[model samples]
Target chain A: MAALVETINLTRYFDIGRGQRVHAVDDVSLTIGEKEIVGLVGESGSGKSTFGKTVVGLHGKTSGSVKFRGETLPQSYRPADFQRLASKMQMIFQDPYSSLNPRMTVGEIIAEGLRLHSTLDSKQVQARVEEWLVRVGLQAGHMSRYSHEFSGGQRQRIGIARALILEPEFVVCDEPISALDVSVQAQVINLLGELKETLGLTLLFIAHDLSMVRYVSDRMAVMYLGSLVEIGKADAVYFDPKHPYTEVLVGSNPEPDPELERRRPSTAIVGEIPSPVNVPQGCRFANRCPKVLEQCRSVTPQLITLKDSERQVACHLYN
Target chain B: MTGVMTSPQTIPALLEVRDLAVEFATYGGTVQAVRGVSFSVEKGKTLAIVGESGCGKSVTVQSLMGLIPMPPGRITAGSARLNGVEVLGCNVINGKDIRGSQIGMIFQDPMTSLNPTMRIGDQIAEPLQEHRGYSHKRAFSEAINLLSLSKIPEAAKRARQYPFEFSGGMLQRAMIAMAIACKPSILIADEPTTALDVTIQAQILDLLQDLQTETGMAIVLITHDLGVVARVADEVAVMYAGKIVEQGSVDDIFYRSAHPYTLGLKLAMPTNDPDKQHKLNPIDGSPPDLFAPPPGCGYCPRCPFSMKICDSRPPENFEVAVQHFSRCWLHHPQARISPAAPSIPRELYVGERA
Candidate 1:
């Protein structure tokens, strides 16, 4: 199957004054199949969102190539290039407050993308706007109201409506449900699931919660210190995670069951995540990994697929 | 942190809260933040108050801590008795004395809670000087030790720096160091790890557990994360729309949940554990508005199995098991036992492979 989106050695960095530079996303290459939900899971400073933004043309790539539908996207988006790309690829921001134009009514917010991408008439646009509002589980009356009038979950639905109005082939959802309440989080997740199935929309679901990612995504990718640690089927990575960081991530997730939580062996990884600016020379996670070998301290392992399996892990133990 | 400080020999309960109600008077109207909330934490036990935002979990704790202001925010009714003293109604609120000596609080954001200009050591040592009457030199030395105890390396040198010098995880450790400076009997941590990364959160949770073991102080944990509640809490109180919908031991709360709201929340959260596999059944709507709280059940509007009486009269506390109480008509024996209880799939609660 042809990939909907592909990247080659995608790297992004920020020079934070002086002689220092923060390596946000370093040499990451991945492919997302058509209509597939690829979940990106990582902790803070893991650069999952940075990678997502770079792919969606929100951030200029420091160096590398991003291909959409076999066409290489420009590293630095020009006005015409970005506007053209915006119709096919869109991004839903993590924060609901800052993402949507608070001044615009919900109708206007959803219609902006449609207006830019399609030539639907005013009557048709209004009809689709109201339809989208209802589809995302909002009342038609909510269309006239501003984002500030809605709750976090409702605002997120508005965000979804806006992102989908363009009928983008791919969408990058950056922590879309993290800010929502648990009850509302489930609602948003289900909404996304339903929309993905009905519209055949491809997604890059970026989140920190491994559980959520594992549930929502068909395949999951783990990033650590701005690099891919593991990528496999969500169940494969979750059921038997390969990388030490992935293992720690799976272990570190607090089980909701109290009995199991108490009974389970403690797998809390020691030490904090190293600063992205001063990342380790060899394996980025070597400083905190429990199974660090002598070679791991001096040589960084490349992500390699295991024999007869689709799973790929970047760790010396597998090699 | 000392269990000896709140010895049960002196007082029957470590902290007793009875029918606590907190109200906030806004220009719109009086918002009932907490209504008839009650729970108690024993010595060395952790009571997790679990709820979503606007559910009054934070307000209930703030009310108990005597942190609420009088004019706009008032403790309309109820009593919080600590050490044989009625601490509510601002009667025993010797701010520095009570809070500094008897109880300590750790807010969600460690950065904002800390003073930017002040040295980290001085901030941690302030409680030592104020409550314990320690000298400057002694407090400084103790603050360094506290920092080390929080697992921060180079504590002596780090203490001389400002809050900005420390990272988020480090700053949280510093906050813990400051909160426990006096070894207070109760440590109230409100979403201490919510802002931190997953791996960093584990370290913080571990640190809290270790501190509890050493000091033997009861902890009142207020958080929205069910996973966090499961990890740290000995007892769990599920809150909804400014009320305690369910209160029980960890086992009862997780294994044999009685209330529909608790079940909804449990089912709502996605589990990474391969052992539990099922489609998530999210509750239909958001929580009720506290400004004009429904006369009957606050959860009636959202409950999947809401009975007719659930909307008109608030369900009385029905005991599901010993020490397990749920405020839902579905659990009441007198209420019609319609086969359509809002129970999550039984398979979800069962552990097959574990």
Candidate 2:
């Protein structure tokens, strides 16, 4: 199957001070198949969000190519091109309350995207808005209400509605349900699952929570300090994570099982994440990795595919 | 049942809260933010208060700490005993003395918790000066030690830097330093890890656990994430509609939860295994409004097994086992307390094979 979206060696760097640059996203390459949900899992400052934004043309890429439907994205993204792409790709932000324009009513918020991309008239837009609102598990009467009037869950539903009303084939769900209550989070996840099937949407679900990502995504990518450390089928990556970072991430998460809780080995990864601006010479996670080799400091590893599996890992251990 | 001894070295409870009820006098009505909530934290152990937003977890702890303001909100009735002293009834002088020295609190956002205008050293020293009346030299040295304890590298140099100079994780460490400056016997952490990413979250949780073991201070961790509660909490308190619906040892609550609300919450959490998608059973409907609380059980409207008796009368908190209790009609003797029926599908309970 042809990829809906692909990034070839995408990189993003920020100049912090004199000659010091923060390589937020460095040489990341991945592809999202049509109607497939790809989860980008990582911790703080892993550059997952930055990478997502770069793909969607929100952030200017420092180097490398982004292709949408086999066409290479322009160096300096044009608004016209961006608008055209916006019709096929949309992003749901981390915080629903802040991402939304607070002043606009829910109706205006959902319809604004449609207005920008679609040729539908006012009546048709209203109908479409109502349709999406209902699709996201909200009432039509809620259209007149402001963002503040709704709960965290309802606000996120509005966010989903706004993103999907454009009828985008791909969506970047950046921690959509993290800020919500537990029950509300389940509702949102379930809703997204249902919507994915109904709309035939491709998703790049960026989240810190490993469990939810594992559940929702078909393929998974583990990132650390702006690089893809591991990528494989969701089940493969979670059950038999090969990368050291993935092992710690999977093990570190609190399991629901009471027996496992008792036997929880002290696999706590100590030490704070090194600053992105002054990232180390070799592997970004080398400083905190428990099984760090001497070669890990001097040589950076390329993401290479393992035998008889789709899994790819960027570590010298694999080599 | 196997004789798994529940007894650990029974240290005196550092903080005890009894029948805590907090209400806000709003134009709409008296908003009962916390209703008859009670729990205790023992020294050297971590007690996690887990619940969704508007579940009264935060409000209950805030009320216990006397952090709630007077005009709108007031503690109608409760006694919060800290270090064998009544904290809620303490005078301004005593409260101030106890706040940083005997009881410390870490809020949700470290960025907001810290003073942007002040140097990190000054912020850490504020509690020491106020509580202990330490000299500048002594306070500064102690502040550096506290920072180091929180695992901030080059504590002496970083002390001179502002809060903005530090990253989110470092800022949180700074917050912890400030919190533990006076060696408080108790620390109330309200969603301290929520703003952080998972890896950073793990680091902070480890730090908290280490600090608890080292200082022998009780920690009251307030959060909505069950994963966290499962990881760190020695005991768990599940709150709903301004009341503690279930309170037990972490094992008791996680494995054999008596409350329908707790069960629902556990079910809702997405498991780490990808094959367990069917296990995620989200509860239907929203939390009830505190301004107009339900006459009976607050969760009765949404509970799948809610009965007629559940609608008219509030169920008394019945003891399920020693030290484990839940306020639900299903657990009541009068109600048809059949052993937890296997109503939920097997796939939802049994996770995918490892």
| Candidate topping DockQ | 1
Evaluate every candidate with DockQ and list the scores: 0.77, 0.57
Model 2: lDDT to the true structure = 0.85
Give the range of the ten consecutive residues with the poorest summed lDDT in model 1 chain B.
B1-10
* Candidate 1, A1-319: lDDT as tens digits: 5799998999999999998999999999999999998999998889999999999888999999899999999988988997798889988889998888888998999998788778899889999999999999998888899899988998999999999888788999999999988888899999999999998999999999888988999899999989999999998998899998998898888878777788877787778788899878889999999999999988988989999998999999998
What are the per-residue Cα lDDT tens digits for candidate 2 across B216-321? 9899999988888878899999999998888888888877777889888878887654544564677878989989899899998888778778878887777778
Candidate 1 TM-score, C-alpha based? 0.96
Residues B300-327 of candidate 1: C-alpha lDDT, one tens digit per residue: 9888788889889987777666678888
Q: Over 4 Å off in model 1, which ranges?
A: B1-11, B90-94, B272-276, B339-344, B349-354
Top candidate by lDDT: 1
List the pairs of residues colliding in candidate 2: none
Give the best candidate by TM-score: 1
Model 2: how far is A287 from its true place, Å?
2.2
| TM-score of chain A, model number 1 | 0.98
Task: Report the C-alpha lDDT of model 2 over A141-210, residue by residue, as the tens digit.
Answer: 8899899998888899999999888889999999998888888889999999888888899999999888
Q: lDDT of all the models against the reference?
A: 0.87, 0.85
Model 2 chain A poorest 10 in a row by lDDT:
A254-263
The residue pairs that clash in candidate 1, if any, are B1-B183, B1-B184
